[model samples]
Target: MAAARDRGVRLGRPPAALPEGAPRAAELRAAGNSLAQIAAALNAEQVATPSGRGQWTKSSVQYVLTRYDQERADDG
Candidate 1:
């Protein structure tokens, strides 16, 4: 581990990156959109999901919102 660190190798899994639509999703939610509505809007806009596959679902939107919130909190 020390040798790898000295060689500039990163340890452990990479940090999670927010999806491209994450901020938009958070904004929509802040604008009082329901989870389903947010999902529909995202799908209509053809935004890529975190997985880069499949359409946005209410659950997925909620997950992204939660993660986005966590990231914001951490940053602040």
Candidate 2:
């Protein structure tokens, strides 16, 4: 473990990444759109969800936004 750490190898599940529409969702949210509205807009734009199989839901939007915020906070 020490050797791996010295080699800069991260040894756990990788951090969650923002999905394709995450930035747009953040933008819509910053513009005061509700989570439902953001999800609908993402659907209207045919943006793929993180899973790339299902439609965007309010919960998914919230998840993406929370992940996005966490990433930003970590970066700063």
Candidate 3:
């Protein structure tokens, strides 16, 4: 485990599942949807959240989207 950590292995509860409409959410955001609006759109599409309960909220949507965007940025 220590050796894996030295190699940058992340040890935690596995990454949460991205909501089904994540790509669409990114598209909507690029087209200028507010975080709240993205959440609403996702909810309207019946996209399941990582937690699998409750309606989508701006914060949750932001977390997922921001993490995804950051990862993408890092890859480039």
Indicate whether candidate 2 or candidate 3 has the larger TM-score: 2
What local lDDT does model 2 show for residue 75?
A: 92
Q: Which stretches of candidate 2 lie over 4 Å from their true place?
A: 1-12
lDDT by residue for model 1 (9-69), tens: 9999985688999999998999999999999999999999989999999999999999999
Better of 1 and 3 by lDDT: 1
Model 1 clash pairs are: none
**Each candidate's lDDT (Cα)?**
0.95, 0.94, 0.84
The residue pairs found clashing in candidate 2 are none
Instruction: Report the alpha-carbon TM-score of model 3 versus the true structure.
Output: 0.72
RMSD for each of the candidates: 4.4, 3.5, 2.6
TM-score (C-alpha) between model 1 and the true structure? 0.79
Q: Compared with the true structure, what per-residue lDDT tens digits does model 2 show for residues 1-76?
A: 9999999999989866679899999999999999999999999999999988889999999999999988899899
